[model samples]
Target: MSENPHDQPETLEHPEEALHRRAIRSFVMRAGRMTDAQKRGIDHGWPRFGLSLEQGLLDLDQVFGRQAPRTLEIGFGMGHSLLEMAQVAPDQDFIGVEVHRPGVGSLLNGVLNAGIDNLRVFDCDAIEVLNRCIPDGSLDRVLLFFPDPWHKKKHNKRRIVQLGFAEALRQKLKVGGVFHMATDWQPYAEHMLEVMSAAPGYRNLAEGGGFVPRPEERPVTKFERRGERLGHGVWDLKFARSE
Candidate 1:
């Protein structure tokens, strides 16, 4: 999708203006209701592994009692979809990375409440978790559903489907591994398609649109529900690692 032109960050012509813009942007970004302490606790609560900044590569055999195929879900908003996937695919290990505090708490609570054992959590940036923590070609699947579209033009650079990011993911995924992504924003979906198409070493799994629905495995999340209510279009893209 073409970026929104008006959403671009203002370019300051003077040094003082640049400083002022930086301060204003920082303050505005942190203006949400979440407290600094809460954010800090979430940021530091998770331990880092050598591969990904967000996750550690401890012995997975210890956690699941046997090494199992691993799938990653990035930005699990409230854990509903992650929980459902875990339930449906009990044999596959799922790792979820999220930075939202309440969402992390809710995911933990849900995992405990539902007695789920095949999942792990990391409450931080997924990029750090994937690049620094996850071993190359170790993951069987990756899921990114309903990520922030950063709809404004200036912020489009912050969107996650850049060439470098896709290349990193390609490295982490095993040959024939699956990468699934969904978005309710049409422009963002198109942008994702363009980005992924340009990335080497991967192939689209679905010819026309993408993979068919594994509805039994991937339940709709609350965010998707709200998007549906708002008459927004949802797009799903699936790709596989190509040798």
Candidate 2:
């Protein structure tokens, strides 16, 4: 559940060197073989549902054909939860950003199978997509579920919930639009709370200004179930863009 598809390096630099240079990326593209069905899905589905960086800034209204509440999810692993959210919402549009090919293919295949028109996907670094494609104050909700924890003490710098990221993400959301994040790693959850609490232009929705109970909107995925079985607790946080 700790796999992420954001903050990828621009070049192949040594890890220590990259760290020293302050070019900390949250993910590494691990090699994974795609199934035949996944490949077919990409071949067939992408032409219809894909959004590209080359498209420049997006007019989201034109993309979905109506101005509706939009949710943009970063690092959707295999798109199970994202698909479910789109299917259930119907009126809301969903944009998913991911760097993994296999996951993107799997999501595309699922979308094609489901015949859902409210979802679109980006197969690229999420930060780049936010900067180049997504317009300011355009999104109603932004979700980061089970992002890479980068648990090592030294590697903590690579975590995505830093102040800079929180601020950047805030710019993409409408005032009062929520940034929702979930994690199975307790330390990472605490880290998210710490950074987001200190970041400007936001207000935590949690009752005690801490972690919140998981909302029904976020589906409990197979990975989450497995983690629950192993006695790993999950934490959910929602912070609204208040500025």
Candidate 3:
């Protein structure tokens, strides 16, 4: 019997390849040179606190060596705010993901100097780390602070707060876990609000379904301070997983 075209099953594209095509990274890596201190930080601190995608799905309890509230911060620039948060909240375990080598180095150095054991780091694409390393529904909180706004109108599509990203974050979060995001760009904030508002399995933590006051727990960043001097208003949004 002759084979019919309809009888042949459609060849499916690899899911990871499909994801790679669909995901437009929001940040551009700048040619920022690392200082000697930063280099040393990477060398010395990596063994103690660094993580890799090749680790596969992590057991949060095993990684931290304790059962504590876990907070994952997507981009900890220079490491100061995240370090401060870790210092203040010793009861909580923090996992920071930063692709910028200099920033990662700085954070690692800070972590070593601070002697804080409640924190760890991943120097890779946050999305990949989330997808391949972090176990689903294992997080207590997820933070996205001052992510690349992709401010230009033509580049807004590259912003990371799209519906797909929100859903991915939701999967990593435990039920009732909160995804807190802060942005200095107003349009990007609105974009985040729109996507997160419509995203399933989330409930806006804002009382009336809009921006919320910046919580005290979130330390103000240097970028935020500079934006403040330029009269840029910061928007903070918190959405909790309902299921």
- CA lDDT of every candidate: 0.68, 0.87, 0.84
- Alpha-carbon runs more than 4 Å astray in model 1: 1-56, 209-216
Better of 1 and 3 by lDDT: 3
Query: Candidate 3 has what TM-score?
Result: 0.90
lDDT per residue, candidate 2, 111-216, as tens digits? 9999999999999878788878999999999999999998987678777777777777888899999999999999999999998898889999999899898898
Question: Model 3: clashing residue pairs?
Answer: none
Candidate 2: list runs displaced more than 4 Å. Answer: 1-22
lDDT of 3 by residue, 1-243 (tens): 221223211112332432244335656665579998899889999998999988999998999999999999998888899999999999999999987899999998888888889999998778788878988889999999988887767666677777667777777899999999999888889988998898889999999999999899999888889999999999999999999
Measured on C-alpha atoms, candidate 1 has an lDDT of: 0.68
lDDT of 3: 0.84
Between prediction 1 and prediction 2, the one with superior lDDT is: 2
What tens-digit string does per-residue lDDT give for candidate 1 at 35-104? 5544443454333211234236555667557789999898887778887888788888988987665666
The best candidate in terms of lDDT: 2
Q: How are the candidates ranked when ordered by TM-score, highest leading?
A: 2, 3, 1
TM-score of 1: 0.76
Q: How many clashes show up per model?
A: 10, 0, 0
